[model samples]
Target: MPGFTKHMYLNDLNKIKSDFSNYIKNIIQILSEEYNLDSIMYILEKYYPYECQILNEKYDYYCLKDKKLIPLNKKVRYLMPKPKSIIRGLKITKKILSKTYKDNYALNFDKNLQLENEELLKKEREPKINKIKEKIDKAKLKAQEVEPSFLDELMGLYERKRTTQKDKVYIFKELEKYYCLKVISFF
Candidate 1:
């Protein structure tokens, strides 16, 4: 409590998980049936912000890893306590003078401790990183595949002649004319 006073006794400030990414698979299910592109984009946008926040927090945590974060005292001496205990009506000064209480001191950053802690943190982050990667890879595979419905016929035409964009457009136009049908250009 003396060292880490933020939010009372909290030590680590790292966020455990992304606020929005937990339901991305469900979001995808409700979107495109084939590519699920809308869901994929949702995951990307939400995941990126969470990644950035995590990176920022990690940066701040290691910012002073190699530098001194607390100043060391030139001499150790306890300032006499003057306040009276509320219930006992007696001075609460003995603890400060105790050897055990006085032994605590701050110093330059400990590189060994930092490395040990960093290794442990990497272990904690590994599974989350792997899970996100798997999710993104799955989304990539879905986005790359052809959609069904009307797109299947369109893609069938597209697949027959896998040529350059210009050639494909020309070929499709030629097919349109040969079939005596008007081709609508979505572009």
Candidate 2:
């Protein structure tokens, strides 16, 4: 059985009471087809005479089966089964309830409005990072692009006069590009 509630029924009743007369009329038609007109009419008159008056004012009517509000809206007309009948004819074989998990954006609708903002920020930073990387890569590429040559590995070696530290410095040229190799701090 589809769950029924007073709040849900009242909301639908208020909708029918406010605008759209067709909803009431459709329920009345269904009631006239299934039960005695006076019995259905008496039920409407007893509990919801105001609704009946609203229908009468608008040349409409309504009916109730059990306590469910059977609105005749085209979208929901076929859903109104008889009272006490289970809606088992439905072909549903699977039922799952979604679990809720909190996220940073869950409390902020604005965060979802700008999913592209993070992506855009990332895209914006990528080019700048790439530009810096390219400069470093170009410097290395230019060094490697030069013609190959060989030079003496050790033209000189010196030890500091005041300290035992070797303070080694190796300077050389490869393909007209100078590279400074220094042993500043040894592990």
Q: Show model 1 residue runs off by greater than 4 Å.
A: 1-50, 53-106, 145-187
TM-score of 1: 0.25
TM-score, one value per model: 0.25, 0.25
Worst 10 residues of 2 by lDDT: 90-99
State each model's CA lDDT, in order: 0.39, 0.36
Candidate 2, pairs of clashing residues:
none
Error of 1 at 15 (Å): 10
lDDT (10s digit) by residue, model 1, range 1-187: 5444333212232122222233232232222223223334443344344554543444444343323333453232222121111101212223322354334312333556645654654565567777888986775564424333454365466666566788678656644432211222221
> Model 2: per-residue lDDT, tens digit, 73-174?
333322333221211121110010011211322333353434554455446545765676688687766554432233232323233354323433333222
lDDT accuracy of residue 102 in candidate 2: 19
